[model samples]
Target: MKKWFSSAIVFTVLAVLVAGCAGGNTKSGTSESVDANKGEKKPVIKILQNKIEITDKVKAMVADYNAYNPDVVVEVQVVKDYLTMLKTRFASGDAPDIFTTAGYNPMASWSDKLVDLSNEPWMGSVSPLTIEGMTMNGQKMGFPLAFEGFGVVYNKDLFAQAGIDTPPTTFSELKAAAEKLKAAGIKPYKEAYQEGFPLYHILNLGFAYEQDPLATLAKLEKQEMKLADLPFLNNVFDVLDLGMKYGEGQESLGVSYDSQVSDFATGKIAMINNGVWTIDPITKVNADINIGMFALPLTDNAEETKMPISVPGYYVINKDSKHVEESKKFLSWLHENGEKYLVDSFKFFPAFTDIKATDDLGPLAKDMAAYVESGKGITWTQSAWPVGYREDTVKRIQAYIGGQGDREQTIAELQKDWDNRVNK
Candidate 1:
């Protein structure tokens, strides 16, 4: 553990204290079951999540669970500004009964708040890959949802039409692909830069494509290397420029993420950036679209490209919640009955070992699956970023891409803000 991060964790304790202390442990399931059996009111289990893609599927799951069980009520709430809201709720000591948790260092920061689910009944039925992805220091903090990957999603048919036979592996090749697509009178890509999160996701992959991103971040934490001195940040700047220069005009600044997905699904653009969560919505628009994904190569060799793949998020129970036991039972139910929902409904690759993929997870996800199976897939490391890093960095990126600033200014802002957050 880095010294600065220890101080950061200590801040969270005072945060929740200044906010308020939580009430007692939640009503246990046995009592709730007894009340329901007596035709009395059932206890409610509240779940908060950030997965905007599967809102409908989760709602349906809640409905189905309520109908069959009839002993406890489950309420699902989608937080649009989930990550930001997650920290606020936690600091306020108002953490939800069960909230979605990310993997890696970010999840570890919440180790004190989360009830370890490693010894839960569902652990035996989950895939070892998932268990590994969600575990930290031998303690599993939450329920792993699925195998996930993200990169640049492209139209294979468009590539062929543009006389490009292969996805770009290096930065130069990506530039060439864009030029060919532009020459073919088709836009090379579409972006929603106005949104911080989509931009944040790009930076995550861009930074990770470096020779050793984790090591680089560790050095940054230790004040050993400057962000600009590294070769990758420069490449990231050029890649940011790549998206902006070839993007779909000024209208793209305001293009919502859904619009980006719809446009890419309809083949209006040759490429887009996103993950497998876009699969269901894209397929719903054009199930037959020859969608493909490749790791965004910011280097000279395409063969070296490795897509980041891992458990993106998990379901965590609040240890201090008034509904801990109820939350546990609710999660156990999902573990048992959610196999089909995980597949047909959510369309995510199931985290459970008992469930098998009847068909491919999706077009892009197929490549992601292969990468993970080969042990070449990278883990999404942005989950380790400090809370305000995304908001701060994205603003600088938006300014740079929008032609309002230069690389020096952007990098300066990044280093300054990072230092402020850590040193505070």
Candidate 2:
């Protein structure tokens, strides 16, 4: 699960920090001048982020801020597997002034190292669901940067060619459609259990089985409920079973996200269960592909149910940041200006209710926007799960998909694990 970080890079960073901190104070004139300048003033804010390439819009925004604010300087560093880097920095007492956490578990674990932004001016602009995901012990520990919705992203042309009139809105219909596509010589659904995350994406659809999964999750955390007692887990097993039923072949383990996406883009697959992030790959293959989206089709009342949606990205400030005010100012600007950047660059739907959907979005994005406006969507499953349970549950799903485990055994294991963790 932590394969994102390479061991050599971690060792190199630790070595550098150790060497820098262990050096004696042999003060040269230049060093003294630098220290004096630091004391006298200009605020320096360091930001640690994953090594994702920045969009031009974000770069332009940063440039504008840098040109205007001479008193504060922002230095951005790209860290591979940012969470590992964060842990290393925390151990060394050299963490950045600001960083990003993937979800609630990491946020909760590092809550003591983050500043509570509940009173921040921009807090009111965010949604209550997002606040709940980012808050720890009733204090806001992070600010959501963007929102995303996931479902079956399908090629309209392919569906039409297959004589399918509409997207599936229920589990049975979805299975039938997959079988039809398969018989038509097109893989009905393309999944990447090899990546691990995509398997979790399928399990997340189980939230739709419950009346109010989010509320139930909260109760489970308080020991008022057990995940095993819920019927949703069984429904989730059925969903995973569907994916395995239509998977490509025996070498499914060799299938990566890129290959699955490529197959979908090339019209080899009718649909793929993914979020807005899949848009880029689709566009790259064929910008003209007519794309459409629908929820997992798990619920009986298709029109009344909403797809699972949540903030896809987050921004958090370091608890030990010396320039807290400056960091907060940057965060404010980020919340205000970041939406346009997301829309223009990544086509991400902004979580801010006041923000309007732009015409620049792809067909699928536009459809998802309408879905959200209908107020039928729920929060992302991973975001709502208790700390430590999310990843373990995902691994279980992967094991099931690989045919190494059974649904009952998987659910029983998860129930026991979650029960133990929540109790502890």
Candidate 3:
């Protein structure tokens, strides 16, 4: 099934690119005619997305919008995987008029294909850092749909059983707590390194502590600072060593994402270092389970801080699109109403200030929301790494975790690769 889905996604992406190029001239003419028609006719907008399963509540909201705006028809094309489909479409220059643009690093790779939405009315509703990461050479390329934070998501019920009352505030405290939980017959931490990204995510938490890590990276590229001189990288090694010490017996390399979450939800593990979206999977296991979250602890010498987070994904308009105005209108609506739909139906936490929390939000989600409101969180490091460097770093971390090499040698190799990419 997975192979079939992957193939289908590849085929659909290729088809979209081919169709876009072949029909370019036709679309140009149609766009002019549509603009001439103005308010007299409805505009049909195409949306490319991977998430197709809209809850009934979201469907109702769309239905309501359709009733009010009979002239606009929203067509959603669902793909199986975001990155592969986007890469295929982008290479063909047959990309969708509107699609997701927020991701680690490669966001800049698509800069030429995206529209500048800096002056959009709804721009203020999203985080500026999110905009910064997606922007290339000063052009805003993506619109954030929701925000997320990664941390220690723990079961409150398990904590109570262990006689713990509050979330750990520091790394040492977390280590002590883990020991206590383990003594109570619980796995202290559960993480999956099968997909490799989780290992890099651990490093990202450490990078959040540096002052303008991304900007520093840009300077490092220009030979202003040595990559080895960065303090955050040292912090990353520190945390990984700590995690490795605690998760000694667990086969991190063998664990799949499903098994990791399942272990936590089934009460086999007391905590998991994961993002806010974990609630979705956890709820599927036991809706009554009580979950809580705390920020990843900062370095001992640094002041207490929360890791950077952003709207986990974004919506970007195609710069060369024929339906630019119409696409922008739809995006504006999405920025305003889409957030509410996502939060209410999918339990998403909106990045927008105007949106209120849904009643059904878990306690941990509420805490994350409050943390963001207080301006405590930093943007995720993966979002800012150079496009090619990001994946390379992940692969290196995965190999390191699986015991492919010693830590110093692995990091030095990665540092060299990162420097080469940045300098290039």
Candidate 4:
């Protein structure tokens, strides 16, 4: 895993040639339409992204971009099961000019299809750690959307009400803290099992706890490791067990992300195993909710605790799109003027060093940044896992947590899935 502490990737550009790259098939008329009144063609740059939570905000941002650049029309499309749908769009020859993909393996899968962005003006200002996930064979093929970290976020006032002095950093302490919160009549956790992604973060802890998490993941990719053979996994399952035992009960399977954030924001729940991304929705629900974040300790070894922090996703241009240059220009404009939206509208920790994260980015971001600064942040190992792995893995986990299978059975199923995914 790359440590993102204070390192920078400084490439002094003699001058930013705001000109377009020289190659690629430009299907001119296909991406632009003649305005009926003016008889003028206005190019359209379509963007397809996966983050449903920020669909509106992204659309709003695009509106602002369109207003600023009236010559081009930038359209945003947010989809569920983004990768699968994106593949479908590509197969149908309806691919967007710009799209989003998670870093590492997912980015690698689409590297050939992406525009090489190594020389993009924004490249100089981005953190090397942010760039690392998007680079393949020396070509930077993707632009990082933001830096993100996840673990456990807790309500500070609720903790105080429960007489808990400090955030727990170990499984035993976590269990004790949960008990205290429960005793005080606060819901210990609002586990959002309805969405497979949150449980993915939980299951990912199994890999993140390994001595060499990325190496261990690579072993699995090469069929040299099995989920059951990995140590500290029982602790990962224990954390899940603890969440279900002390959380909002089996009904948690129906708890949507919105409700989970709202519950925590309103003091209905004291803690939740989520990420800094929740800060935006949380502030909208209740701006004054005092909260803090800490690594979800996977075992009794407090020393092993670290927040999983990495570039959650990236924006890449389709190399073959007719609007490749337009897409690049749009991305450039967004990043150059996006600091305000990134901080205020998106509640993001800017991946680019030029955009500073302000003090008001919420306690979760601040605490996660501290972890990154202290070199205690770990990789989001799932980013390197097989594309579409989480949807299946989280389902099996939900089954086990729902009492549909034994732990061994679930692990076996997980291993079988990995083998089939790798081989097929």
Among these predictions, the greatest TM-score belongs to 4
Any runs in candidate 3 off by more than 4 Å, and if so which? 1-42, 52-65, 90-94, 103-105, 248-250
Which tens-of-lDDT digit does each residue in 153-271 have in candidate 2?
89888877777898887778888888787777777766766776676666776654466666777787887976667766677677666776787543565678899889888888878
TM-score of structure candidate 2: 0.84
Instruction: TM-score winner between 1 and 4, please give it.
Output: 4
Best by lDDT: 4
lDDT of 3 by residue, 251-359 (tens): 7767777998888888887887777767777888988888888777756532455644655567778887777888998777766775466566556666455665564
Candidate 3 colliding pairs, count: 6
User: Model 1: which residue pairs collide?
Assistant: 26-322, 26-323, 169-302
Q: Give each model a TM-score.
A: 0.81, 0.84, 0.83, 0.87
- Summarize candidate 4's per-residue lDDT along 19-39 as a digit string, tens digits: 111112223325775566676
State which candidate, 1 or 4, has the greater lDDT: 4
Residue pairs clashing, model 3 = 146-311, 147-311, 307-378, 308-378, 308-379, 309-378
How many backbone collisions does model 1 have?
3
* Residue range 1-424, candidate 1, lDDT tens digits: 2221111101000000001111122243322323533657666676767755556656677777777866676766676677788888768765678887777666777878888788899888775645544676788877876666667889999999999998887889999999999999988988877677767777776556556666777777777877777666677777777887899654557778888888998989998866666666788899899877877776786666667665667788888888888899888887786657766566667666676654545666566656555555654557766666767887777777766778888888888877776665
- Distance (Å) between predicted and true CA of 268, model 3? 0.7
Worst 10 residues of 1 by lDDT: 9-18
